[model samples]
Target chain A: MIALDDTDRAILRELTHDAGQGAGALGRVVGLSQPATWRRIKRLTEAGVIAGKRLDLDLEALGLGVTVFLGVKLALRGRTALGDVERALAAIPEVQTVEHVLGLYDYRLRVVARDIADFERILRRRIMTLPGVGEVEANVLLSEERLGGPIG
Target chain B: MLDDIDRRILRNLQGDPDLASADLATRVGTSSAVAWRRVQRMKDAGVIRATRADINWSALGYSVEVSLRITLEKTAANAFDEVMAERARSPRCWKSRRFWAVSICV
Candidate 1:
């Protein structure tokens, strides 16, 4: 657990806002010199707070237009079964995010596809065949309203 | 709308955003000017949004990630708006979707 000061937080915010910005530009926003800012960023990266940079892709532009959440329940619940399911999920590229939740569902999976027909094909072909898989409730996403931005 | 060269450039950038235009040009087998222009065009077209750093929240002592599935009251005129407005004020409300799932760490 790393304790971040205000300056550290500001630097993180600025970097996550746009890492492509030069050290000088980031320093100007975060109230540090270029060298200082670079050093802080290096330290943060080394400390594992800053994992790496990512190129956020436009999914629709990439032919992934439909998004759905699957509330999954497994017939057999155990460590091995859970591990197997997770490994299977990792193998499927269309599955974007997976969360093991504490609720009526065992897992919540976010998946993207070209459309409903494509989604149906993936669901029938891949998702359902996983070991110990039982019931899955599909929730189609209509509109997404992000309240707060990504964590810095 | 991206050509083969643009896709190649994007693939390289997706791997490492820190690559300079010269390095990118070398890797993509294009002139530095062309590499820079293509990147600028993608940015301008919003195909490439903000290039941002990835933070490991788990490493920062955020061990618990929660997913909340909520069903809102559709009868109220401004129910969703009010809820979102209230949530937008809190930093802890990292991500909220209007449709179904919400992932947060407490």
Candidate 2:
């Protein structure tokens, strides 16, 4: 594991807001020279603390106005078929998030669309088409107090 | 450069991004300059990443966030690589963190 000092923690907090900010500015805020800050950032990335950067977007702007979770059941049990189904699900545009789940269901998904009509379209046109799915149940999310980032 | 005062600053600042530098210093039991310096140092170290922005996505008329979890048939050829690629291009997922052959959507 990569050991981080207090200074490192501070750097993480700042970068979480805007990774695009310049190194010089970051160093200026933290009392390190630009070069030193650069080195530290490099180290953090290498250590997997920084992970990766993403371009966050608004769902409404993209015409995806609804969000829901899905629990999926598969009718077929073959590993090869399972793999094919996975690929098929991934190809669908409406799928936002997908995971192998625990509990009553075998898998879950987060999906989005402009409205219920649109969602139904995706369900019929795309989701249900996956080869091995036995059943898929969807639940619209209510509220999200938090998404990601540092949640202490 | 971060001392005890710096830790105090972090605790206060992370909890409240709007806390002014003066108020932040006061909370940390340090002079404004010391607080500023320590905060600067901590920032450089990449610990405290950024000032929090309370973005109301819904206020901007964004839809609720969708969450997804998917499983692949374990025996399919190159299925992992295929799903992984879709995970990369997915426009709807706000957060997609990879796990052991499984991905978490947020």
Among all candidates shown, the one with the greatest DockQ: 1
lDDT of 2 by residue, A33-73 (tens): 99999998888776666645543344554356778677788
Docking quality (DockQ) for each candidate:
0.42, 0.04
lDDT of 1 by residue, B13-86 (tens): 98898789999999999999999999999888888887878778787788776767667787998987888777
**Which 10-residue window in model 2 chain A sums to the lowest lDDT?**
A143-152
lDDT of 2 at A83: 64
lDDT of 2 at B65: 50
Model 2 TM-score, all chains together? 0.54
Chain A, candidate 1, TM-score of 0.84
User: Candidate 2, what DockQ?
Assistant: 0.04
RMSD of each: 4.6, 18.0
* Candidate 2 residue lDDT tens string, B22-105: 888888777888777776676666565555333223432343654455667779998978976776565444454433332112
For candidate 2, the per-residue lDDT at A85 reads 71
